[model samples]
Target: MTTSENLTAPRRPRTVDEHRAFVASLLAPMPAVEVPISGALGRVLAADVVSAVALPPFDNSAMDGYAVLAADVAAASPDSPVTLPVPEDIPAGRTDVPTLRPGTAHRIMTGAPMPAGADAVVQVELTDGGVETVVVHGHPAAGQHVRRTGEDVTPGATVLTAGVVLGPPQIGLLAAVGLPTVAVRRRPRVLVLSTGSELVEPGSALAPGQIFESNGPMLAAAVADAGGEPELLRFVPDDVEVFAELLAEKAGGVDLILTSGGVSAGAYEVVKDALAGRGVEFVRVAMQPGGPQGAGRLDGDGPAVVTLPGNPVSSLVSFEVFVRPALRAAMGHPHPMRPVVSAALGEALVSPAEKRQFRRGVLDAADGTVHEVGAPASHLLASLALADCLIVVPEGVSAVDRGVDVEVWLLEA
Candidate 1:
């Protein structure tokens, strides 16, 4: 298309919100899969997990002490202790516990099953620490030092609701509930493709016009951090046929195909060239740093595609703004967007009148302000690394003064 044709095109640039929604619509929620509790970390549960057996399973001792009726030691004191004969020992996981008769004590260990007819436990410290004959110098109230059955969790109760992320505690809860495996939303497998003839792998000697490729590793990290499995396809040549062949070979194995670079109007725009009219839709989003974008499936049968800009900052910023949330939403995450807050700008800034600007910044949470980390240039990568948040400037507002509160997207750890 000629420049005049592009300028007099049928429609204007797509808005950021429109493009975000379009990209997100490409990947739907994945079906549930049963995974071992050992591998469920960071995965979202697709269904509510009900407790098969109550936590603790049965009434047990919460302390290493003697089990006795509260009334049996009611009259005991430091000056004059009550003596009782210990006839049984109850250790954790031991069955066949004998019922405690009145005026008799049973030596018990922490987590031991509670003996029948025992209402409380007098700690070993409060007694003479005797195994056969115990002296009770203090009284334990009824239910004290006892882990009652069904108190922590009840059978048939939902221990973890659907859409909850599985962390250490959640995994522990599942194991405690006797679930060796759990049904969770499978993590999206994403293929990251970085295209450029000028790109070379890191740790290699760069030729005159070649530069070390970083986008593939960067985007893959972002994908993994968003709870998706990432596979890297780096240093794709600028030739359309080569790129297309590589994509075809890898598309079937991934839920989504993410590419960095070659979506703009410039020469050798391999992503746009290879994917145009092949089911992917390319458009210039009305956003700074990441204006050129594309989202669709290859040949209508392959995996979804999301093409980002080449500049290091733009590539990462676009992923944070668009791709990450979409991948998360497709994984059944309830809140797909990053945590956003309003903070005053540490300094004044300017933005394009028709583009929403996402500038990297360091958020001063203590001061309730955000400072720009680097210049507005998308090629600045060091600033991107130093930034912990993105300061947003909406379109139609060209400038923001210092102390003016603006929306900020807080980057996760």
Candidate 2:
């Protein structure tokens, strides 16, 4: 079947919001698996994690000091020090000591459990030390220098909620609560392919009409950054039968299929030729660099397929616009896209009519301005690399003067 025969009448060009919502609705969270705590970083929690025990577990000394009753040190001062007999030496990780006597003190190290009948701690630096006797010079109040049980976390409290991505601090908390493993959502398995006859991998000598295939690795990295595991398929030539056979062979275990190139209106578009009538829809989105976009099930086998444009910059931008959000949704991420805000422009800018423009720029938030990073050409990968944000220009607008308020999407925090 021909591409035109498969597609219905061309629909109105979709806005960014409409395309985003459509992609989001096609993705669902993957299954959950229990992973060891040591490798849980960057994985989203599949279930709420509750503290198994109270943090600290018992009252302990926060500093190296002498544990004693507050009344015993009330009358002590710098000039008139009080002497008390040390009945026991308490160190951390030892639980064999007897309770402190009323008139005596116990030498306690930092993190050592506070003995019963001890209501305060006099720091060791303020006392004259000996095996059986010490001189206390400071007056301590009740509960001074003592860490109360459950001060950090109470048992049975929900410490981390579902869909939260685990980081260093969270891993530490889970370890402190005696959890050796965690339940995290499985990473989405993505099958990535690049289709074209005029493309060659990097490090190979290029022919007269061939260029290096940069989109495969670039798209793979993008998928990994969005928390998906990318499986790269061998590059396929401009043949529809071979492309369809390849897709049918690899569609069983993949959660999604992502292809860069060969989905445009060119006559040699193998991906469009093979997938035209097989449940995929190719449309021209109302955006620059990434105008031609396609999405749907791949022969009704895999999860879904998103076909991006052929240009390297266009492929990357399309991933940022479509695939990244879908992968984030499947991983249960709360916020899929980079954060957007308004800022003043440092220079004048022009854009195409009736198409939203995502121009690469550097944000100078300290000076409340966004400066264009480089030339705003859609094929300039260097400009995109240097940019910290994409200054968004709305459709139907042409020129933006310097110092005008504009919308920007921050690439990093």
Candidate 3:
């Protein structure tokens, strides 16, 4: 179903694709803001960038040599060498224009503006490297070794288009075109909150029932790496009332609110309890490991919310499949998803009926195959850590023999 129908709690379970599309529609595109060229790296352009000044700016010397008229140096050779008086020395950045005297040469440096009457430059290596008088050994063609204005780029030319990510090269281009700043889509600010009374911070002594909390910091890191500004909110008491109050207090400041845990079927489902009637809709997606999903606005009006399952691997896989792409798209990213490839399975595997399976794997690139790294459980953090890609098994298929081709989602670019 379309998100415009309103993603309230669904009467039944939702498919993986259906829930993904719904979650993608949750976030509105961030507005554009002007920032300095130095601050534009890693940002996406919101508008086309046109050059105000032509590259090279003016006709300049392309080599450190002597500026001479092409006809003056045309007959110079070892057998009939021509000697010309050097009337002036023109270094790069010289302000006043010096016209090349009809038959005389002007010593010029690389990037120096071409003299008003010069049509070519003769290299110092070919001459005697003289400052006052120089002996030309070779002929120079017309317009040789001289940079022309508007050759590389012209004024009013579109150097960059909208939705292009600004990297070092792009930023350098903007600087070369004399733009001090540019307009780009602003990064989406996200507040990451994880719930559960049994969760405890790492590096501390834990009670008998408490395990170390990981989802908060991990998701925050993921959010930051995906080009979103992330703020971590942890250690709030796992009560429905406290959670509700915190949401109301912190909702208006950020673009998205991401919460993990307490959405599954359990006795202490705090997220499900607090946001059940408010606006967020929790549902089970027809997928492996990360089936329990939630999305919508808090109080039907506040910041967009997406709730994920508590297991470490499940949380990560859910983010990769849904949140990461959505967040990048919201920031105006051109290619929002990870690269995927097809490879043969190194070993046999089984998948549950009517559910898509995502298995951590290591790819044998030379062999054109992938092998599972860890079992299918959602809490297997070690396997996820060692994995370079995720092997995807589609729904409706239960088993596959060795060497069967499967879809692989590469983790790195």
Clashes of 3: 0
- Superposition-based RMSD of candidate 2 using all C-alpha atoms, in angstroms: 3.1
lDDT of 1 by residue, 158-188 (tens): 8889999889999999989888999999889
lDDT of 3 by residue, 86-159 (tens): 98999998989678879999999999999998999998888889878999998889999999999999999999
TM-score of 2: 0.93
Stretches of candidate 2 off by over 4 Å are 1-10, 129-131
Each model's C-alpha lDDT? 0.93, 0.87, 0.91
lDDT of 1 at 270: 97
* TM per candidate: 0.96, 0.93, 0.93
Q: What is the lDDT of candidate 1?
A: 0.93
Q: List CA RMSD, all candidates.
A: 2.3, 3.1, 3.7
Highest TM-score model number:
1
